[model samples]
Target chain A: MKRSNRLVVLTDFFLENPRKHIQLPYFVTICETTKSSISEDLDIINEVFQNQGMGYLQRSTGAGGGVKYIPAFSRENSMQFIEELRKKLEDPARILPGGYLYMSDLLGDPRTVREIGRVFASAFSKVKIDVIVTVATKGIPLAYAVASFLNVPVVIARRDPKVTEGSSVSINYVSGSSRKIQTMVLPKRSLEEGANVCIIDDFMKAGGTITGMINLLAEFDARVQAIGVLAEADDEEEERVINNYTSLVKITNVDIRHNKIEIQSGNYVENHTDS
Target chain B: MKRSNRLVVLTDFFLENPRKHIQLPYFVTICETTKSSISEDLDIINEVFQNQGMGYLQRSTGAGGGVKYIPAFSRENSMQFIEELRKKLEDPARILPGGYLYMSDLLGDPRTVREIGRVFASAFSKVKIDVIVTVATKGIPLAYAVASFLNVPVVIARRDPKVTEGSSVSINYVSGSSRKIQTMVLPKRSLEEGANVCIIDDFMKAGGTITGMINLLAEFDARVQAIGVLAEADDEEEERVINNYTSLVKITNVDIRHNKIEIQSGNYVENHTDS
Candidate 1:
């Protein structure tokens, strides 16, 4: 193939497999090009990826060391996406009967979901995420989005058990906001033992649902390496059920009858951004 | 940006917005390039995409005509994915109590889901799909995957009513296999009225669930442009509740006691491949 053809193929591959390391020889074999030529092509690709702020390439000289594509967003860029999302989330029309915020519209949008996925992926870029864990049914899409960008699988815990999944492990936990006990179950084969898991959800009220996922991960001996949510409702106690978690939007207030809602950027803006 | 940079940017944009038409001048402004230069670049990109079978570019000359990226998989490639997936799915270990296939693992897999999404997108490339719809829990990921490729939002139907979503429209449909009436609900604001919707699901037993979705779309004055499923349970009648649809795999047999299962590629193989 010609150099342009190789560049196009390589670009497609790298973008699809973000955060994956592609060995040098593998590229030479696939592109039917010499090692030196492949190396030169990568340099050009890397420059474009970096200049575009899409991702970055890491190089190391040693065994088990090759080109790794790390998708990233500058702190400024990350904040921009979160702020724009926060603005949309603060609309009073999204207020539900309870303290909940209706986020189905936002969650259902592919463009919005893709941006959120990229933002979360950038935030958790440093962590090792083998699989993404979420609870059914609303969190499934958000978790899937994050997992896709991270190039990992998603394991969803269901509140209602179905016989179609064979045997399962169940766990009961307290709801963060409702203060009600809820049962969530995961299929036996849903996750691998000792896997590094990342928990993602569409909304967090009391932090209880995410905590349930954390406890559920323990059944498989998997570790919760990171926790992220699209929105998190604030409480008077000022401490969530699960600590060390990041949320993109912080819901400060929701007045149902008055049709009022208030929101601000979450910890992600302060933590994930450069300036 | 230079021509090389323009090429890279254009490739990424087209890949992300599959099935969406982009006018020539839009690229001219975005890439800071002449119309002739942008057209030349698209030709090169089109060649690589066609050769790799990832997608193809369509060109029209008259007014209201523009370039469109159609994601597709050649018949040989579509069969390869389905056959390989069928082999794994046919394992007795994946058998559930009532002849159901345990597909959560496959559904959660990003790579596998991407291929399934590509096949479905390719199959429905010519249709007018304004939105993708699916019933919640298991089908959310599959729906999200397809929506991403099609560059459309996903509207998921809920089995249980949640107060957070405000007003909703509910529908009752008998499941094709269970022969039991089940209720599925969608928020009123989930979809635009009269939109062209493509319904997708994880698995279809009696074709009842998809039928429910098609009925539900009627409440929104929406048109069912297409229907797709990851797997279809073969029935004795050789016809499902919904006559118009596509499935990636056909489950021929499942015997739990004997630990035997059988599968084959679905109708998509004959319909989607570019022979």
Candidate 2:
């Protein structure tokens, strides 16, 4: 195949199997090119990826070392998307009967969900997350999006008991906002023992659901490596149940009567230690 | 820039915006390529896409008739993956209480979900689906996956009523397997009037949920263009509520007492009218 054709083929392959290491020899065989030529093609791929902020390739040297394509949106790209999302969230028409904001439109948008996934994946890029965990219903799509980027499996916590899941571990916790006792369940085989799990959700108010998830993770011997939310509802008086979490947007204030909403950049917008 | 490098950028962009038409001038500004050269690059993309069964370019002639990339996986590829999935479904361990299958793990896996999306996208590629719709919870990820490939937004019908979604139209539907009444709601503004929609779900028994969706869609003046399910249960006595649907796998038999599950390729496995 010509170089142009080979480039397209290679890029497609890498994209299909993101975060997987492809050895140099494997590439030479598939592209029908020498090691030197394959390496040059990779250089162009890496350069274009970096220049366009599409993603990056992690390179290793010597024996057994190979490159892996890690899908990531650049800081600028993430910020730009988040800002637009923030503006969308600020609309008065989004305010509900209470302080809640109607974000179903944003959640349903493929571009918004994918970009949100990219932002979270970029934020947690340095972390080792074996699985992405979230509750059923609203958070499932968001979890899947992030899992696709991180190249990991997602384990969802279910609110309703499912006979298909077989025996499951169920727990009851107080809803921080409503103070109602709610139950969440997970199948025994859904998650691996000692896996590093990332907890994600669509919205966080008083952080009760994630708190329940943290407690639930204890049963699997899994540790919470990271926590990310699309939006966090800020409550000045009541303290959040957990910390060390990142949110894309923070709802600073919401007035139902006046149909007013206050929004700002989230903690995830700040630079964090890279591994 | 070289033609080889430009292919990388252009292909990446097209993939990101799948099924969306891009005018020729848009490529000229983005890739900094002359009109003639851009046309040549598209020809290469179209050839590779067709030859490899990757996808096809829908071309329009002259002004306002730029080509659009419609993502698809060849029939062979789709069959290979679906057969594997059928085998996975046949595992005795997947047999749950009351003949339910343990498939949360499969739903969570990114590669599995993406391939499932590809199969559905290929099956429904001919249809004009303005939006993808599904009930909340298990179906959200699958819906999002199909929507991603179709390059359309997903509109989830919430099982739980939330105050956030302003005014909503709610409908009660019977669960196919359980025969229990369930309520689902969708925001009034979420979908456009008279839009064409694709209904998707993870599993179906008598197809009550999607049938309810089909009914609810009428309230919004929308129409169900297509229906796809990952798996459908074969009940000997009962007839399915909805017809003319595609399924990747069929659960032919599920005996909880004997811990046996028989799986077969679904209606979608056959070659249909390829528009």
Candidate 3:
């Protein structure tokens, strides 16, 4: 294959298989080129990727060394996306009854969801995540999206037990907003013992659901490496139960009667800057 | 930008934005090259994509003309993937107590789910789909995976109504397997009127859940363009409620006593061959 053809093929491979390490000899064979030429191709691809603020290729040398694409969104890009998301959430039309903000549309959009996933993945890029754990229904998409970029599997916890999942471990926790008790279940076989887990969700209010997930993970002896939410409600009335998490946007206020909403960039931006 | 650099950026763009159309001028400006150079670059990328059985770029002329990447899987590649999936399903240990297959692992794997999504997206490559619809839980990931390839949004139907979604349309239908009535809800704002939809699910048995989704879509005046399931049960004891659907694999038999399971390629392969 020519250099041009190799570049296309190599770029596609890297994008599709992020964080997947492949030996230089493998690429050389596929590209029908020498190892030195393949190394040069990697350099060009890496340079372009970094210049575009996408990510860079991590290369290792020696007997067990190769290259893998580390997908990290630049700080500028992440903040830009978050600003756009905050504006979208600030729309007064999103105000629902009972002071709720309607955000299903944003979560339903593949592009938007993937972008959010990219931001969260970038936020936790340094964490060693063995698997992404999320509750079923809304958070599943975000979990899978982040998992795709991280090259990891996702295990979803469900509210109701299903016969198909075999034996499961169930935990009951208090709902943050409603103050009602709810049950969360995860199949015993879904996760391995001591697996590092990253929890993802669409929204967080008082952090009860996330706390519940943490308690559920305890049953399997899984370690909670990170927690991420697309949006978090900043209501002072309700005591926040969990801390030390990353959020893309914060809903400081939602006045249903006045038909107004307020949103701001979440802790992710501040944390990113501090780091 | 040079042709080598252009290939990397263009390939990444096409892969990320699968079905988005961009005018030739737009590419020329981004690549810092003339229209002729951009055209040559597209041709080279398209040729490599087609030769690898990945997909081809669709181009048009005139003022409203542009290029879009239509992702498709070749029959050979699709069959090869399905064969691997079938073998994986045939594992006796996947059998649960009630003869249900424990496929959450496969569904949880991003690569496997994405490949399954690619196969389904290619299967319905000709259909005019506006959005992909799925019921909450297991199907959400598959729906998003397919929507990512199809470049459409996803609307999820849930069993319970949430206050955050605002008003919703609810429908009651008899679940084919249980022969019990169940309610499915979709936020009224999630979908527009007369929208074309593709239904995706993780599994089908007696087609009850899918049938319920079809009935639910009717409430929104949505058109069901296609239905794709990762797996379908071929139990002779239970009558199948749906026929006009595509399945990747059919679970013909699951003998709990003998710890045996039989899986075969679904109608997708046969339909593709016939076409």
Best by DockQ: 3
Scored against the native two-chain complex, candidate 3 gets a DockQ of: 0.93
Q: After superposition, how far is residue B216 of candidate 2 from its true place, in Å?
A: 1.8
Query: Candidates' DockQ values?
Result: 0.71, 0.79, 0.93
Model 2 whole-model lDDT (C-alpha atoms): 0.86
| Ordered list by TM-score, greatest first | 3, 2, 1
What ranges in model 3 sit over 4 Å off? none
Runs of candidate 1 exceeding 4 Å displacement: A63-65, A237-239, A256-258, A273-275, B60-66, B236-239, B273-275
For candidate 2, what is the DockQ? 0.79
Worst 10 residues of 1 chain A by lDDT: A266-275
lDDT of each: 0.84, 0.86, 0.92
Q: Candidate 1, residues A1-275: lDDT per residue as tens digits?
A: 67877888888888788777878899989899998888878888788877767777778768976897787866767787888998898887787766678888888888788788888888898898899998888878778778877889988899988888889999999886667898999999889999999998888866878888888889999999999988887788647667788889888889877888889888887776441
lDDT (Cα, tens digit) per residue for candidate 1, span B152-232:
989989988888887899999987776788999999978889999999998887677888888888999999999998888
lDDT of 3 by residue, B1-275 (tens): 99999999999999999999989999999889999999999999999998778988999999979999999988889999999999999999999988899999999999999999999999889999999999988999999999999999999999999998999999998876677899999999999999999999988989989999999999889999999998998757788889999999999999999999999989888787511
